[model samples]
Target: MKKIGLIVNPIAGMGGSVGLKGTDGGIYKKALKLGAKTVTPKRTKELLSYIKNRNEINLVVAPGKMGEAYVREFNIAFKLIGQVPEETSAEDTRRIIGEMLNGGIELLVFVGGDGTARDVYDAVGSKIPVVAVPSGVKVFSSVFAVSARAAAEIVDAFIEGTNLTEEEVLDIDENAFRDNRLASKLYGYLMVPNVKKLLQAGKEASSMGKSSVDSKGEIARYIVENMDKETLCLLGPGTTLKAITDDMGLPKTLLGVDAVYNNRLVGKDLNEKGILRLLKKYKSKKIIVTPIGGNGFIFGRGSKQFTPEVIRLVGRGNIIIVGAYGKVSKLDCLRVDTGDFEIDKLLSGHIKVIVGKKEEMVMEVRC
Candidate 1:
């Protein structure tokens, strides 16, 4: 029997509201602001149905939302190697990868977005062949399947000895993201190696990322409306945040994050440490960021401008998230990660990032 590893990023699409763009990490709050819904059980059910009768494949799955519950729903017995923590992060995904690698699964199937792909890349890299389900906002990479049912087709083909190809994995600019900048670095390619009868690995797929242009415009209007005195608004990348700068009719970096104060660019792509220097003048501050679709990472991958010190200086409560509906529903819920373990903890536990006035959103994080 061929071994396969399955993982589902449960909250992968929760950032599709308020124009934050992606919901992987920093933008889930925007999803809440825009009234987005989760795409969970339905997507899960689809996968379960396809794999229900397969016998040539041995399924090794991560527990709960990862695959266990869905497997049971389809009555497909699977080996449970690990359980996702009640508040699981991409860390859990990596842990599962370790297990899959140790067990030497032939193929890895991931469910989520670009951020999720990055996580998978970090864990498995080019060691094995992988195919992803396009369940996130912006799937900029080339390792994904065409559609939900299409994923099943790939699996079937792989089992039948189809050949897959190598794909390029992108390294995202997290620091620029907090300031509303978008610069993607091409890390390299991992060859999945075409199999004779296995399902053919797909090419780059479409993205659910909303145009941040209008959202940034709206945010700029809000900043202008509220920027009477000394409040500083730190901006992050993506079209949404760029909208704010655009509304001001100023050129903003689409790939890097920036800060807006008094209707002006204060800083650009400031990391956690960089924000420390800028924080000296601004007592009242606001940090803006887009969410990563699927992976739900708030800080590690994108929005590196809002560093731990910056978050502390600005206060997590003062952070504002932005996104549109298309970005949020990519994942069933929302997610966050700052890269720093202790900071992840400090930022965890019912943190309230500003989504809007009286129109705020909340997330339950495990730091």
Candidate 2:
């Protein structure tokens, strides 16, 4: 029988939406005291639903509360082979993944947000095929399904002899917390179903970069020259691309991505809704963004302004990647991460991003 691994971070995303930021360390203690119920452990129903009908795959579990509870809730018979650490952190998650790899499991399906992804990445190192069911507050990496039901659908596809693909998973800055600082770390990679569209976690992808002084004055000039007063130009976060905000003579929210049109500020630090609001106010919209060096993720870090709905409305053609010529030429391929997997897949194509007018360079971008 084919073996499938199941594990759960019971308190993974409990603090989200409740204004607690994330559940980590003793934060859950504070949450319980704050009159908050531990939210459903991330992605419980979704992974199980995938196995509800099929008898082809046998499930391998971590331990009692760790992995067994989930399999039992699904009424699926599973063999508990590894012990789950009671007072566990992300490292424990990695340990369980390592155990599963040794067991030769066919697939590794996990639940949680970016933290969980990091654990799996650390343990598996891109050799295992994995999928994540969305159960966290902010899913930013391309490692999860859109919903619990969608995850079930993906598992069903796999069981029915569908092909899967190896996809890169990313890590996030746990120490950064809610300080409005985005410092991410790359753990490793994983494989998932071959579906082109999937929802990633609202993770703070732990990617970092050097604080270099890059003069974006020329790129800013180009944007200002090309922008039509009638069209809306959505400016994303990061010090490099934000120069457009200054050239437009509008005060930039250093922490947030904003929108400008007809020489006026329409939105500030916009999320999916805020960007869509700006789009509705002005139908013709253009999105401007820049990728952090060492990590090619285009969206989902500090810039939630260009949300999935907004990107869809504005369309990919209007999206622009602005950076120095040196920054632009360093990439072999452009990465797509809009916090929405389906939309990210929609943008899966190769394109040349021209950073400055005088300095011409070509970079391959995959959506």
Candidate 3:
């Protein structure tokens, strides 16, 4: 059987719903105090559940909540690699992955986001191929699969014999991220199964070229012209969406959710609780969002504040998608991974995107 290793960063995505942006350093404790829950467990279980070639491989997993907790539920053969304390940290992730590598694992499957990807790159480098499950808040790295199910597929492909390719691992500054600045640099690369269709594209910085700027202005003008003054508009994060607020002469959180009512700034940098409170007060609500430039994700990437409940309350009909032609044209299709399969299914299908003034494109939304 092909030997595979599994590692889970238990505290990876605890900060997303609470508006902490990332769980790096000591921010995980703050996220816990704010009622953030463990996100990697469900993601690990989903990845294990969807792996069709379970019997064809043996798993070497880290002990406790880091890995063993979820693998025990499955019938696959696995062995514990290293011990971890009750409260796990990035050091635990790095140390355990090193042990797994020394144990001669042919491939590794890790569940977490950008930080976790960096840890894996530090441990594994280009030694063996890996399948990265996207479970963390800022999953901007191209090394990750689009979703857990996709990660499972990548694993099966690796076991079935696929070529390996190097994917980038990005280092994101959590402190700068919380302060409304996206500071990132290329940390390193990890070898992954070359299943191009299953992998996600790395986040591309917004273009500032003349054509791109003009396109954004046209989109902002068109949205403002057609906006309903009586509706409460929840604007998702992105410079493209921020252009709309700038056009209205209102401030916006560059990387956080904001609320607008009758062209007035009602809320800024809203968390899940804050968003729910606003949804309760207003009956007529609409959500304006722009997809990530390269990844084409409208939800479940940068803005986790737009939870499944929030999307349900806003309803599918009230969601407005806006992007510049330069960005939308490069994407194959739009995607959404709300962590709830029902909500993802609800969002999948054909949707209209406003690219410029009186210009719209019908794009398919894939779950």
Model 1 CA lDDT for position 155: 75
Candidate 1, residues 75-113, lDDT tens digits: the string is: 544688876787668888888888888988888888776
TM-score of each: 0.52, 0.58, 0.99
Candidates ranked, most accurate by lDDT first = 3, 2, 1
Assess each prediction's global lDDT (C-alpha) against the native.
Answer: 0.60, 0.64, 0.93
Alpha-carbon runs more than 4 Å astray in model 1: 26-35, 51-53, 174-180, 193-367
Pairs of residues at least 3 apart in sequence or in different chains that clash in candidate 3: none
Clashes of 3: 0
Tell me the tens digit of each residue's lDDT in model 3 across 267-329.
Answer: 999989999999999989999999999999999999999999999999999999999999999
Model 2 Cα lDDT, one tens digit per residue, 246-297: 7778876654567787989887655554566667778677888876554455
Question: Worst 10-residue stretch by lDDT in candidate 1?
Answer: 197-206
Q: Candidate 3, TM-score vs. the true structure? A: 0.99
Model 1 residue 61 CA deviation in Å: 0.9
State in Å the error of residue 1, model 2: 6.1
Q: Which of 2 and 3 is ahead in lDDT? A: 3
